[model samples]
Target: MKPLKIAMMSMTHGHTRKYYQTLKDNPKLDWVAVSTANDEVKEIFLNSVDGIPCYNSELEMLDAHPEIEAVVLASENSEHLRQMKLCAERGIHILSMKIPTFDMDEYEEMIDIVDKNDLVCQVELEMHYNPVIVRMKELLANNEIGKIKSFNATNITLSPVWAFPWQGVPEKSYGKRVHVKEGDPRFRGGALCDHPHIFDMIRHMTGSDFDCIYAEVAPNIRPDIIEEDMLSVIGRMKDGTIFSLDPSWSKMEERLKVPGPGWEVFPKRMEVNITLNGEKGTVMADCFGPNVYHNGCPNDRYTVQYTYFDEWIGLIDEFVDNIRNKKQPLINLKWHKRTIEAMNAVYESIATGKVVKL
Candidate 1:
């Protein structure tokens, strides 16, 4: 298959740094250009960047690299729509960050634009590609554990505000400034917006749709932001599988600009641990754990060093296959709508203090 001529937009996202190696090393992609949100981000992007041409404006980058076939929209939440429109207008395929947009109408517009352009639009929920998760899916499909009565998943991670400040802003991170309730100062976009993998995963695991969602917020670890740093949601899938999710920025951090070592005040920067209760048996898995440990460096504390990082390889490979072979990706826009809808239901549940129906 021919390699995809790819580009990345907005270097300010938390996942921007993670994609650098994947974009450059993947045999299926040719990372052609990058456009940052501002001069500060541009300087940060260029200072350590290797060969890719870093542009100050998307127009300039697109004009210079007209052959660029695909793009990874690594922008802030609010910038997704504008950047997506630009990519769609150019007929470029997209790999959007997890939360595309909170507004349903705007989200629908994005879908329409991409479909009209006949482009592949895949969302980034890297947990879908994790090997441990791949194993879990295989096990569940095989019914190694009988009917799942309840599932609990935790996607807790250190706050990215220090690294990606835009995430801490209500308007920038949540797509708008939304009051959760009459007296609640914290807006709708916060830790919940940052973590949607568990929500999305439940749908995949149970092969069901969202039924209703109930959410509650906790006291913020960092009180400076308008977004909540902690949240919990309990819901039932249409298939009758009950689930609970803890999508909080509960881990501690050292305020590093880039996501790297010594970046976490806690030993592990992130955790995606899950537990399931079933009729036949039960299982617990840590998708990103049981990893290599290290006690070296700036902090001599023992750390679970990550060894597996091929999610982008699988994701990009799928995109390439979709383009080259004319097959739809597993996480395409159409397939991901339910996940987005489920996420929205959580917010609605929070606002009304009642279970939101799908």
Candidate 2:
């Protein structure tokens, strides 16, 4: 079989570096060019890694590697549409960031572009590939939860905007700034904008759409931001399963650019703990760990050092397989719309101060 050639664009994202080892190590993929959003991010990429040529611009990189078949849009969430369109027009398949364009109309346009080009557009929700989550999925599907009547999930983490500046920007992260409610100091973007995983995961687990969603915010822990840092959403699934999800930036982190030992001030820097209450029993899961403890170099605080944390490996494998074999990706456009819809409901709920039907 021919190897699938893939490139990565906009190396400014927090997950950008995480993909490096996975891309190079994947046997089926020929990792190619990398383009940064600007000269600054380009210089940072230049200084950090090896075995990959980092280009200052996409056109320059694509001009060099015309054989490139796919690209990972590892840019800020705001850059997704423009970057994907560039790849789509070139007949290159895309692996997009977690949050695509918040505008439903633009998202629909993305589907149309892929349809017109017969291209793959897979949104990266990496938790789907986690081993623990995979096991959790299997057990839940095997009636371990005994009919999910409700789901409560948390995709809580520190605000990465300190390192990835775009996330803190209302215009870039949220696409637009709208108030959550009257007299609300916080804007509609921020942490809520950062997380759509649990929202999407609930859809995946139950195979049901959200019936309604309501959201409320608490004052941000950090000052000088138009976006929210704390919030919660409660809703009902299409199957009448009541659910609640907290995708807040509730955890505290040491201000670090390159993630390291002391990065997390909290015990867990990131978490995707799920709680499923069913007719017969309940299932609680932590996709990241049951990790071993550590207090060695970098930071002296005892930490639940994670044993397995790479989700990009499996995600890239699937991307390669879909490209080489001409199969649809698991997180394709049509499948992700409802997740976006559910997220929009949170914005709508905060807007109207009432439950938004999904």
TM-score on alpha carbons, each prediction: 0.96, 0.96
Q: How does residue 193 of candidate 2 score in lDDT?
A: 81
> Best candidate per lDDT, number?
1
Candidate 2 structure quality by residue, lDDT tens digits, 1-358: 6778889998888788888788878888888879889877777777767878888889999999999999999888778888878998799999998888888888998999999999988889898999877887898889976889999999999888778888888778888877778878667768988888998889888888889898888778877667888898898998999998999999888888656678877767888899989988998998887888877767787776878878998998888888777889898888988898888888888878898876
Q: In order, what lDDT does every prediction score?
A: 0.86, 0.85
* Reference-based lDDT, residue 106, model 1: 87
Which segments of model 2 are wrong by more than 4 Å? none
**Backbone atom clashes (below 3 Å) for every candidate:** 0, 0
